[model samples]
Target: MNTRPPAARQIVIGVVLLVVVAMIAFLGSLASMPHTDGWYAVAAKVDWSPPNSVFGPAWSILYFLIAVAGWMIWRNGWRENQPNAAQKTLTIYTVQLALNAIWTPIFFAGYPLIGEPAWWIALVVIIALILCVIWLAVSAWKWSKPASLLMIPYVLWLVFASSLNAGVIALN
Candidate 1:
């Protein structure tokens, strides 16, 4: 009895999802570049504007983890069997991704950017925290405590990012 589905299919799904998520995150990073090097970057330039080298690569790694985490949940026989939580989780994942992608434009491209990037930063923090909860539950669904454990750093990183965003807004 093939209790589990195909590992190959799950791996493929993981890869594709990772790529898509990375692309979206990268695009959002690019969209924010003009401001990063200009207004916000210049104004916030001191000893701590965040290392440019760290941002994109860090986000890419996070996206990859996200894809793997999602695939793990899917492979737990939840996507089809535990339809409700699975659906909610996936929907939250998409919403968080969309929110992550949109924050750049709102803070960078919009005229009268308003309270600076603080608002977008706060929103990202909230969304990321929600995702952490979702991912934790998704991991728990499979009785994989280690898997749920993996998302802790990610949640902490988001908290750090919120602080950085606040710092930037405060400086600039």
Candidate 2:
């Protein structure tokens, strides 16, 4: 909005926005959690798979990074002269977040309900997510280097997660 509130007020807005994004991501995770212990507990996994204990903290950190990254890019895009760019960036952010929110349920809930087809669907969803993440980073890099850099950890985590999904498919 660049209505240019005082710097302190602007910072408050940024903080609130980031917190809201992170909270939304966290809430989405809750949806997938109920689906986990069912089939996921018994699902075969790769030897390299980290313990179940690792996911919560890892995702928590990644969600914060993603939130800040999104805010940085969106903030940059919203400059007075850049409304069109802001719209495009917002679209990228929405698509990736939508994909992220759905993936776990597809992989975790879908398997128990639909069998192997669920994993396949999850795989497709993840690949799309990875693409969207890359798109977000590229767009972010153009607007803010810090924003793009924040995505690196997310990329690494998603790659590891993708392999885990693939491993389960092969093992089961």
Candidate 3:
């Protein structure tokens, strides 16, 4: 007899999750020192590279979407009592987040300093990152269609990032 739809709780949790995701993304950006010291300025970029100004806003939007998608999945799983699927989906999501976090430092800082092995390592990481997002998209589709729809931009961005990463590897 108490079906109020729980919007308040969901909103709170979603906002909290958004902050957490933003923090994680901020830390990743910090670790990369992406803008402060002109690290990216020296990197060899292909003609298709977007302006440096685009990355910050693009990533901010993507991360917000990512958090919302995760929150949607979390809310559904909590309501439906599907702990196993939730766990798997969250695990994939976490892995992708971790991969996204490390990519900037690895590609921009580590690879350039260490030479060939580092470059190869960055490529491997990017490939793994791509795989993780793909998994996230598929798992989200199975768990929540809206969540899956939410992930499309992130997936597309990652695909573009993979090409950029590959280009960096080839050029530098």
- After superposition, which runs of candidate 1 have C-alpha atoms over 4 Å from their true positions? 45-49, 78-85, 111-143
- Residue-wise C-alpha lDDT for candidate 1, range 1-172, written one tens digit per residue: 1245467877787788888787778787777777666766555644554687788787777777766666665555443433434455555556656666665566565424565644565556556665655565564555444545556656766766666665655565
Please give each candidate's TM-score: 0.73, 0.86, 0.84
Error of 3 at 24 (Å): 2.0
Give the deviation of candidate 3 from the true structure as CA RMSD.
Answer: 3.0
Tell me the deviation in Å of residue 36 in model 3: 6.6
Task: Provide the clashing-pair count of each candidate structure.
Answer: 0, 0, 0
Task: For residues 58-161, write the lDDT of model 3, one tens digit per residue.
Answer: 99999988998888777766643334346789889889888877777776667447765665777788788878887888988866799988888888888887
Give the candidates in order of TM-score, highest first. Answer: 2, 3, 1
The lDDT per prediction is 0.62, 0.80, 0.76
Clashing pairs in 2: none
The regions of model 3 sitting more than 4 angstroms off are 1-9, 34-39, 80-85
TM-score of 2: 0.86
lDDT score at residue 46, model 3, on the 0-100 scale: 81
* RMSD, candidate 1, Å: 3.7
Best by TM-score: 2
Report the Cα lDDT for residue 117, model 2.
Answer: 93
